[model samples]
Target: MNGLNTTALVLLIIGGINWLLVGLFQFDLVAALFGGQDGIIARIIYVIVGICALYAFTFIPAVKRRHAVE
Candidate 1:
């Protein structure tokens, strides 16, 4: 559970940064490295990141637990 949460968090951060780059500079880092939006690798990365964001949603319970501890 800990590992999954950590992985999800990392992926989520990556996705967030990617979005920031897009919004600020009109650049798509993931697509650029992987070869554009239609590229196979880029699509896979988008899917993986999307899944990670969804998975991270489950961490809300863990977050509550941590805050409760404090």
Candidate 2:
């Protein structure tokens, strides 16, 4: 993938891992690293990740098309 896709995928992975940590151990890596959930930096990161998730949905049709070709 290109740079934007790679960045989005990485952020998605980070978000996924954060969710896993929250599910299993009640931890939030991003908040802990940046500050608490209410911290400005943490909130910015959360917003970016959410935006990336929406961007990722745009890939679904391409993925389906690729799979259908195969």
Candidate 3:
């Protein structure tokens, strides 16, 4: 709802797309931007994305449906 949450969502979406690309084509956009997969910056970006993903776990659509019924 706020900027931090929105930013986290965007990062998570980007992470998801990057995974899709990797799974389908062995490509990784985050690694490309932060420099190869082994780079510290790339690893940090990955960690942030991972954290964002964990943060988003509570926001999944199925929970929204359950909450709506209550």
Candidate 4:
């Protein structure tokens, strides 16, 4: 689970950077690296990143636990 969390975090960071680039410069690093946006590879990359983002939800610290520290 730790490994999975780390992997998901890394992918999430990459996705965050990609979104930052898109917002600031209208660039898409993944699409360029994997071909064009419609390319199968690019679509797969996007899908994986999205899934990683979803997986990242598991890493969220529980609010109750945070307040339970003694």
Candidate 5:
């Protein structure tokens, strides 16, 4: 995958892990590491993760095309 795709995947993984922690233990890893949930850095991370999730949608068509070619 290209760099941007790789980055989006990594960030999505991080966001997924953070959600898992929040669901299981009521913890917010990003907030905990950066500051509170309202902290600027933490908010930025959240926004980036959300955007990456949207970007991930683009992969659906690519995957379909790849499978069709095989």
Candidate 6:
């Protein structure tokens, strides 16, 4: 579970970076690497990023419990 959480966090960071680049420069790194937005590989990347977001949503609460200071 820890490994899964780590992987999700890494992907979320990647997705965030990609979005930042898109917002700042109108560039999509994932599309560039995978052959454009319409390509299957690019779509898979988008899907994985979204799934990682969902996983993070479910994970944060437990993470806080595990790391609580009190």
Best by TM-score: 2
Tens digit of per-residue lDDT, candidate 4, span 2-70: 788778888889999999999999999998898989999999989999999887676566545767884
What's model 6's overall lDDT? 0.93
Give the alpha carbon lDDT tens digit for every residue of 1-70 in model 1: 5787778888889999999999999999999999999999999999999999888778789789999999
Better of 2 and 5 by lDDT: 5
C-alpha root-mean-square deviation, each candidate: 1.3, 0.6, 2.6, 2.1, 1.1, 1.7
**For each candidate, what TM-score against the reference?**
0.89, 0.96, 0.80, 0.84, 0.92, 0.86
Q: Provide the lDDT at 21 for model 5.
A: 100
TM-score of 4: 0.84
Tens-digit lDDT track of model 2 for 1-70: 8999999999999999999999999999999999999999999999999999999998999899999999
Ranking by TM-score: 2, 5, 1, 6, 4, 3
Clashing pairs in 4: none
Candidate 2 pairs with clashing backbones? none
lDDT of 3 by residue, 1-70 (tens): 7887899999988999999999999989889888899999999999999999888886778678989999
TM-score of 3: 0.80
Q: Local distance difference test, per candidate?
A: 0.92, 0.97, 0.90, 0.87, 0.99, 0.93
What lDDT does model 4 reach?
Answer: 0.87
> Residue 61's C-alpha lDDT in candidate 1?
90
Off by over 4 Å in 6: 66-70
Query: What does candidate 5's lDDT look like per residue over 1-70, in tens digits?
Result: 9999999999999999999999999999999999899999999999999999999999999999999999
Candidate 3: RMSD to truth: 2.6
| TM-score winner between candidates 2 and 6 | 2
Higher lDDT: candidate 5 or 6?
5
lDDT of 2: 0.97
User: How do these models rank on lDDT, best leading?
Assistant: 5, 2, 6, 1, 3, 4
Among these predicted structures, which one has the highest lDDT? 5
Candidate 6 displacement at residue 34 in angstroms: 0.5
